[model samples]
Target: MEFRDLNISESIMERLDEKGFTEATQIQEKAIPIVLDTELDVVGQAQTGTGKTLAFGIPIIQKIQEKIEENGRKNKKAVKAIILTPTRELALQVHDEIDSVNKGNKLRLCTVYGGQSIEKQINKLRNGVDIVIGTPGRVIDHLGRRTLKLNEIDFLVLDEADEMLNLGFIDDVEEIMSKCKEDCRKLLFSATLPKSIMELVELHMGEYETIRVKSKALTTELTEQIYYEVKEHDKFELLRRIIDKEPGFYGLVFCKTKADVDQLMRRLNDENYSSEALHGDMNQKQRELALSRFKSHKIDIMIATDVAARGIDINELTHVINYDIPQNPEAYVHRIGRTGRAGNKGTAITFVEPREFRRFKYIMKISKSDAKKEKIPDVTEIVELTKTNIIGKLKQLIQTENSEDSEDLENYEFENLEIVDELIELADSKVIIDKLISQLFKEELNRKSYGRIGDYGSRKGNDGRDSRRDGRNDRDRRDGRRNDRDRNDRNDRNDRDRRDNRRRNNDGGSRLFVALGSMDNMDTRRLLRKVLEKSDVSKDNISEVNVYRNFSFISADEKTAKQIVDSFRSERRNGKPLIEYAKR
Candidate 1:
């Protein structure tokens, strides 16, 4: 049924329409009605992207009729609803969905998750919020700090319950739930109702309604899942070819580490692919900017590590490519779940090194995806793919460009035909394409004389040799190394420090525009001392502290700025702190 049928606000319905959501998925269809009817507990069994968020969110938003009060004003700062997810990513996703649905409504949403300053979250709480969506750890942290008051919570939601269990967050989830009022409305969503989840339901829920919607079952008809075994070294080149050949497809490439994400991003950029990176190391603002660009279709691919991609929900994901196989089956599910959402057709491809074949099989078995194998594309195939991609892009360019003028049309026609002819001659047909692909594969094989994918040092259980090399050299110097080596160590440290200092002090931490009142009542020295005491900053880290008539700014390293943001998040600082990465 339509979102409007759920009796949600008109603005929310409009948002759903804009997001291209019309009919409710099975989970939403069943759970929304039950949730809207009463404050009774709900237990929904469904995988990710089964419209679970809207299922509970619509009811939570509709039913929570609490009066919000803030700062001697009759306003509601006490949250009417709380949603807990296992990861910061999932938490943010749920929060964004709820926010989209509650657009134009008087709901003040806040998210609490790790990999961020808890003090910052506490400050958000102090600013007042009506709904709290967070990870279990951060939520519990807030509870301990007395920043998150759940006693007044009317609705409590446990999303991705199985993930929470798998992540060992069940205990933290229970603790956070215990802080909620006894009569609070409770709802839980999970892919499977394992024994642990059932136990949680039994212990916490009251007169709950149950709804089950199997994601794999629903998606099997519309989606394709496949894996290709390639050498680890060849994955990047393979991904580039696939991206070139896949017409009209927007994709995500998941990497295992932030460094991988950055490396892949740079590679894609250098190769002229419209791409961006997302990782936990990036701040919330950076993550938001990247996501925004991606959603706006400014970027074709997002190279991300899982940690940084928590809480991201993009409905139009056509493909999910595992550049590196996920560490766990659950992660495999999560990564692929980004696609095949809302009853849409999607594809998930995993690149498995020969050594990782067994791990891939295990993941397939655990996830129970209807996965099949794909042969590695040979060199001729890669060349043909590159040609095909160029042709496709040319066609698109011509299609969108204004061709009103005869001369423009003639130029486009000639240019298109020329490109097409060149591509056709390069690899005439599928047979020739395969031949070219094979030839390129052979060339690659010959060039990689040092190692093959399966025989790479990565598969030999060697880790972090790169990180240890510098230390080894340093130790050698301390043990009476040659004069040259000693000189190198001194220069290396200076260079390293210079680079580190540049990254932190891009704009030279000068002044902070603090948002506080009554400068005369504020002591600059005392505030600086307090900031230092509350944060992880050392005295030597700060160069100076400047206080103006209305605000205070600090000069320090980027690390020190982060420390201040973390420490003084809950403290009453006079004015807004300019605690951000300074620009060059």
Candidate 2:
């Protein structure tokens, strides 16, 4: 259905057409008429990328404009509508998309979120806005400051209410709603209708109309789904290898937590891969810069957590890799929906650990999506593909003899044409050509240039698929291997036995005691990573890390040591302080 069919005015229809929104989606086609004609509250259930913003945005703008014309410019800057989102990214996205539809009108809009100056936001609010798009926390802050008055708002929208519930913002949402006009027409939109969402509807939208539309991406037909069963330790190796296998891979990779995103992004950048991290910890400027780089193709891969990835719409994404499989099938569907958008073909790849195979199967069954087992390609195979793909992209560039390509590539190889002819005559023709080609792609053509990926033939069964077992059993095996490694390094343990002498001498370094050890999930690598992340310490400046059953110690420069000590006052993991210096 088209916007014109929904009784939208010619002016608004012209704006929609200019933005290429010719056809109305299921929710838009159904909900637009109700909002434009009726006074009942609405609850719209649709997929993430299913044009939910426009569904409510169009009617809101039209209704506001109609009110303005009917009332004769009396409430020019009076707040009439408020749209609340779960995150800052989603807030900005809604504001931008709706602003496009509200263009050429006298309507005013402002977006408020944390990580920006509150004073600036206050100034914007005082300037008399018609519509406001913001996150819950910021909206509550504005209300407390007495800068934003919602009592005059005629419409209130809770976008992504399920996400708001997951983020523990439902309480805040209720508080904001309580402060709104009692008779305001409320609209609730979410991808899912959890019990909490229904509770919200019962409390606020007593007489609401509902619209639920199932999008085709839920089945994932346009995406080729594949999974490789690998151990947790070998997942990074497989990830790197798969990345090398596809030369044109440009997409997002999902991690389960922010720390995982940071660690994986660090490893990828260390290996010279174009990548960046997006998570809740990053400031708004940093997140915007990372997103800008990803969209402009300056980086080929973006590592993000699920919460941080909400409201991102990149229609040309080629792939979506699940580095950590989501816990539920709905979350899985949401992650894979990033690709196969705008009718483009895409691929969804997942790495299932030994213990996750059954859970993954359950997800597949619940979502009714088909996934095939794929093996990690060999290094030699990746090298061959790299050469072939690179040649395919640059073949026309090297065709110097062709004079038909717009001034012949605009003089790309024109200067080298005479030299090529001279060189061909100076040596055997085929020998010269082969030597030139090999030298041209020296790094890409070399098998050793690609790093080593582990061999897992022993882990595969007779059927050429992974031999699955409990991850706890695999951990036991790894523990046994660690014990052997410790036994082999007894000489290093003997060095630690001379602890008193080193503590007194200090070896021109400071030895600090850590409050955690093996029992608290402490280890040399993990402790080092935590310390370096919290402070300005260089890895080379630290040494002599020793972990015991209940405590640990490490040596670093006095500056790094003091920074680490000060950082722990606020730094924590899983709500527990990670480090504390000895009382001396």
Candidate 3:
């Protein structure tokens, strides 16, 4: 049904029209009315990408608007609502969606997540924000710091509740709930109603109204599901071949971990494929940049972990490749759901290792997807496909050029008449075409060789040794030497640092306590990226990044450290500061 029929305010309706959201999805339709008209808490069960954000967002904004109208805008600074998500990406996405709906209505909203400046979030809170969207970790950080007060919160939303439980944020969520106004309306949304979710609801929500929107089967008729049984080591090669064989290929490749995402992206780029990595290890800006590049076609492939890939919406995506299959069948459904959208045909291909066959079958059964086992195309077949694609393009070009009228041709200038005449004299059209095709075949062969996709079989060298084995040995030796050199350099640097510390009594550098670490999916690169993005600190100015469970410390020169503190003292991670001078 139309959103206008739901009695949405003019301001919200206008924003929806601008966003091209005329009809609401099932969850939105069912949940919006209950949220806007009732005082009872809601438990909404729907799959991902079903517009859960706007379902609760619209009503939340409307309620805040009503409160403002009754009490005047002076109460705008007080946070009236908070939305908790399992990941920083989801939090940002929810904030963006709700903020867009609140356009012209003027609701002050802020997003809090780790790997960002906590002080900035605190400042935003201090100035007064109507809504705060954040992850559980960052929310807990703010709660402990007393920078975020929920005593006056009118609405509290737990989005992706099952995910939060999976990530072990249930305790934090319950704690956050305890600090909120006892009468605050709670809304819990999840793809599945796990036992943990039911327990959470029963404990926190009294007499909640349940809304269930049954999701369609995971595999859609518009999407062709296929799987290739390949050795783990050969997966990359197979991926390369598929990309080469498909014309104008754009895909989202899902990996299992941040390390897998990074390594796969590196390998793809090294093979001359345009790609970017998205994982929890990347800070917010990096994640946004990667998504931007993917959307703009600056990169053709987005290599992402399942968690980092959540809440990312892109149209015109042709395929979803499971570089590593997800353990959860529901996750598999979500990954493939990124494509085959809006009636456009899409393909989902999963690379199944031999050891994973049983699990893969379980996934197929649970997802109800009729995935056919597909054989990987050999290099020769890929080369032939490439040739056929090129010839098809050439034919189209010829047809377009020849389709012009004789009068149009008469108006064209013959800039190279003699060159054409000489070519015609040397060779007939068939000979010329044959020569061109030969050149294209040779070029495709050369490219395949360069990409190493053509070297699936073993080859022997002139010295009676396998060339592949020799290559591996050479690479191992190089890696060993590099490791040795790095070890030696690290030892020398440690020695120098010890001597310097003794001389300066540890006064030469300062340490800062950042409120992010392993729990927030932070790493050295992400920490460095966050520092560089939020402050003027360079890579060389920061050192000794030691991450812990809930916090981290970094050492820098006194001057640089002071600048960092000054820049980030008002910033936050998740919703707390990422840096502070080490407590002496």
Candidate 4:
């Protein structure tokens, strides 16, 4: 139903029209009328990104508008509504949405969150605001400072209640609620109704009505779910292959921790993939910058942890990759929900190691998603796909040119008709077209393959410098004795080259041992990517990457090596420091 049909103010309808929001989402349709028409509390249960903000936001704004119309505008300066969110990002998002609806400045709105100056928030509150949106901690701080008053607040909203509980803010939330007037109408929105949330509702709300928007078995029907059972060592290669195979691939790769997010982002950039990392370690400005780049398509991939990815609203995302399986099943749903939005087709792929297979299965069972198993596409398959895409584009061009509505083509004059006729006389145009296509395909394939296989390919035993040089020399040899002598010399040189290469690959530079390796789904490419992306060391300055099951060793120039070790000395993955210099 349209927002205009609801029993809301005309000003709201005008603002909604300006924002291009004609119809209401499911949650909005069900909850708005109840909030506007009655005094009862509400519990809205729905998945994230289903427009819960507007569901509660519209009613809160409308109530404030009504109070202003009923009472004099002079008396409406007090804070009448308060929205509590799980994080500062969410508070900011909700504040923005509400501000959009309050276009006429009829109701003053302000957001309070940690990290910004508390004094600034105090100044805004003292100036007077009709609605206050904030995190629990910051709101409590304001209450403690006596800078915020809730006795006059008539509307209360607890958004992402489950997330707030998970972050251990339930005590603060209850304390804030206790500060509010007993008659204030409370609206709680959560993805899941956990036991703690239920108890909070029982204690806080009075005769509240539950509004649940049932989703499809999968969080999104537009997303095609799939998984690949890959070994830890091969994941980076597979990731690269998948990226190479898909031409407009913009994806979000979800890792399990801040360390994984940092490591994976570095690796992707090292391999020339346009990517950025988002995790708790980044400050607010850095986080905003990374998110802005992703939204503007300045970067094609976003490597993020679950907590850091919250309140991120990007509608044109193409894919979501589970680089590491989430411990919580609902997290998987939340991660993939970022894509397949606004009726666009999207894809979600998960990489599951053998050890994590059971955990993955449990997640699938709980999420009620039947993600299909798929094999990683090999290089030949990717080449064929590219060829097919090119051919399809050519066929489309031909069809468009030959269509009856080709006014542009009719206006054009062919100055080379004689040459075209000669070409047609020599061979049917179909044969010539096929030959040209074959040549173009070969060239395209070669162009795409360059630099894809990194420098490690040259380090193979049979593919090294000595064997190639000796093979060329053998082809030029004539006499058997001379050829034999040359062969012996070449063999000796080959042996020395092999030994030297091995030494360089093993211990040519200062070494540092990292605590995460194959067991954590890490390999040489990932290790190098992590070190280089997070440190000042260039890829060429680094050599000798050896990965073990639980730990790994890397070597770089002495100065760069010390820098890397020092940089990561206090850096952590899963709450532990990342690297230490190896003992001799």
Candidate 5:
């Protein structure tokens, strides 16, 4: 349905046209008329990228405008509505979106959130605003101080209600809703409605219409799902290979944690990749700057955690790389959904470690992800692709330079041509051409780490079989245990590292033993890496790792080996250490 056909005013319709909001999305088409004509509360269920804000905002704006028209300027200046979001970034996003529809003249909005001055927000509320967009915690602070009043608010919107629920904002949300006028038209919009959301609807909403926009699936068909079987340590190396394979790679990469997001982002930036990081630790301004850079194509990659990525507004993206596999199937879908949007084809790639393959299998079963197993492209292949791209750009430039109709021609080309004529006289054409092409090839492919990824050949975990005699319990246990361990490790990282690498010798000559070898798919290199991940055991400590069918032997200090064994004890099956112990 079209926006013009809706009962919205001509001026608003004109504004929509100017902003290119021509057709109503499925949710908007179904919910707009209901909202515009009724005073009843509403529950709109739709995905994040769907136009949920516009659906409710259009009617809310018109209704607020209507109330103002009837009640005089007093209604215009009063706070008539409040929209609550889960995060500060999301609050700002909702505010900007609604303000765009309102044109900021008829309606005033104050967005309050943490990390900003509470005094500033209080003053804005004191000055009387028509609408408030804020996160739950900040909004509650205002409510407690009585600086913001919602008693007269005619509309209360809980956007991203599920996200709020996940963030433990139910009580705060309920309190905020209770403060609104008894007859206020409440609206709850969420991608997924948990039990708590429905409970809120039943408790606070009367005669509310539940408008669900049915999903074709959690993931779209436009996305091609592929997984590369790579070791954990080589994940970054494989990522760079993927980037090199595609000369114009532009995408969002999802990491499991904020630290991971920062770590990957720093590495990418260090390697001269145009990249930015978005996560919870950054203040609103920094997040906005990173987002702005990504949107404007100043950066080609945005490395972000799942929560911080919620506020992303990009419609077209080329790829979504799961640098660390998400434990939740829905999360995997959510991450991939960021790409292959606006009807454009996108690629979603997962770098699955051997240890993670079992969990990946379970996620696939639950989410119905049809991710194909793909081998990471070899270094030679990436180099060849890079060379081809360089030559392709060179050919394109030559074509543009030679064409009379080409307006993109640089004036510098003429000057370069004069120099080229002189060079042609001074040297053989073949030599000059060879050197030029060679220089371009070297410059493009000179990345030192480009060819360093190991070939973890043809490990297909695509059969949905448990890689490690894994069951549902084991899967659940692994997820929960890993999460707990990672959180604990982050808290006392230095202490934990020291503990993991207990008695280290200056010479690094001690040897240790580990159980479960080739049969468990554990090789010398992989076993050594596993030790290093959990311990401060340097590579020098483990000079040679010898693997047998059912056990392995490695080098480590006597106490360091004991500590490594204790560290992985939780991973033990049949009451063995996670990494079995042996005295040298």
Candidate 6:
């Protein structure tokens, strides 16, 4: 439905036009008219792209004017509306959207969230604001401090209500609601209405209108959703490799925090990838500049946080990489929503460590995301991806005949080959094209790229380099002592053999000493077999398997021996008996 169909104020319609919004989404089409009709409660259930913001925002903005008219400036301390969001990033995002649609109009707006100083927010509140968009925690803090007087508030909006519950802010939300005037209008918007949220609707919202939109909570039909299980220490390097391998991937890499986004952006730039970052800290112009670079095909990738990407409405976004899986399932839908837009196919790649997969799977189940486990791209795949991207770019440049640069390209082509002989020149040009394509990728190669094979960061916590060095030194000392003892024993044996005029022979195989005991209730045989399978050790290489009541022992090659010992010591895998190398 068109925006004209809604009975909103003329000013709001002008602002919507300015923002390039003509048709209203399903939620907006229904919720707007309902909200505008009465100052009653509303419960909107829709996915991220369904435009729930304007549905609630327009009504709240309209109600503020009515409130100001009814109460007058004499009692301006009373805010007309309050929007409670799940995160500071989301609060800021909602505020921006409201601000954009309500520009060139007389409406005061302030956003309060954590991370930023409360002093500034309190000062803004003191200056007198009509609307507040805030996180539950900060909003509660303000309500307790009596800095934000919601007693006179006419409207209340809970954006992404399910997320507020997931973040454990429901109690805080209830507390804030208690502070609001009992007669205030309430609107609860969420991707999926959970039972708790439904209970909230029943208790708090009175005679609410329910609007539901038909769309997959998470649709992977047109997109491929995959994740790589990497250790925390290795994520950065692994992400670096993925970026290098995925060619022409116009995508957004999502990080949990703004700090992470900034650091990853810096690292990507250092690795020579044309990437930029978007975050809350950036000013309006900076945000616009970064987005403009992305939209114009100047920037290949955009690294952003979920909050920073809230106001982003870029088309041609093909991939959404979740560098960190969201704690809230609703956020997972929103992040992936940036892609698979306008009927275009998209890919969402998440980096899930082993422990995180449990939570990841839970999100998938709730969001109904058709995410599948995928093999991480090897180095060869990355190289091939890079080559393919470069070749595509070159082919496009050749096909698109530019009047100004056509002669230059044509002359260069002639100089490089025998154009006088048609077939030979064609064949030569093809060969040169292939050679140049390889060279292009070679130039763009990330020299710092390395697949981190089982990181040691967890073991070297507290003190980074010092701990690693100390561990290595202690291992070296232990090995050195064992070697010395072996030398002395062999020397004595040789002397004995020489004296007896007989050949020396040895029959005992390599021994593996385990640290686990009967006290731990470990099944020795099962543990031994699992160890061999996990390490991919050959059965022939494994000699005598000795099972002790306390600690079991296995015999294997020196390489397999060290791997088994390290795997047990790492404590990463579950269901494994905690057994370290007692002796070898």
Best by TM-score: 6
Off by over 4 Å in 6: 69-71, 215-220, 229-235, 247-250, 254-265, 276-299, 303-318, 324-345, 352-366, 375-584
Better of 3 and 6 by TM-score: 6
Residue-level lDDT tens digits of model 2 in 138-227: 788788878899988889999878766765677779999999999999999887788889988998775889999984546557888998
Better of 1 and 3 by TM-score: 3
Poorest 10 consecutive residues of model 3 by lDDT?
474-483
lDDT of 5 at 532: 65
Candidate 6 global CA lDDT score: 0.71
lDDT of 6 by residue, 470-571 (tens): 433422222112213323444565686675332211132345666554555555445544665466554445544555576776665566566776766655
Which tens-of-lDDT digit does each residue in 6-37 have in candidate 4? 88788888888887799898999999999999
Candidate 5 local Cα displacement, residue 61, angstroms: 0.7
- In model 2, which runs have C-alpha deviations exceeding 4 angstroms? 72-77, 214-219, 226-243, 247-346, 349-381, 384-438, 445-584
Clashes of 3: 19
lDDT digits (tens) for residues 164-221 of candidate 1: 6765567778888889988988888887788999999999889988887755642354
Candidate 5 runs further than 4 Å off:
75-77, 226-240, 247-345, 349-440, 443-584
Tell me the lDDT of model 1 at 362: 46
Higher-lDDT candidate among 4 and 6?
A: 4
Q: TM-scores of the models, in the given order?
A: 0.53, 0.53, 0.56, 0.52, 0.53, 0.61
Error of 1 at 557 (Å): 31
TM-score of 6: 0.61
lDDT of 5 at 216: 57
lDDT for model 2: 0.76
Kindly state the number of residue pairs that clash in model 1: 25
The model with the greater TM-score, 2 or 3, is 3
Encode model 3's per-residue lDDT on 1-584: one tens digit a residue.
99999989999999999877899989999999998988999999987557788999999999889988888866556789999986665676677679888999998999987656668888999999999998777787788788899998999999888766755566778989999999999999987898989988999887689999886765678889998867665788789888988888999999877888898887676446899999888898988999999899999999998768875798688999999977446678889988898888999999876555554664675466778776677677777788788889887866665456423767655568788778889999799777777765543554324223223222233222343343334222211121133234445657977887554326678888998887888765466557765676654556456667888887887887888888888876777666777787
lDDT of each: 0.68, 0.76, 0.77, 0.76, 0.75, 0.71
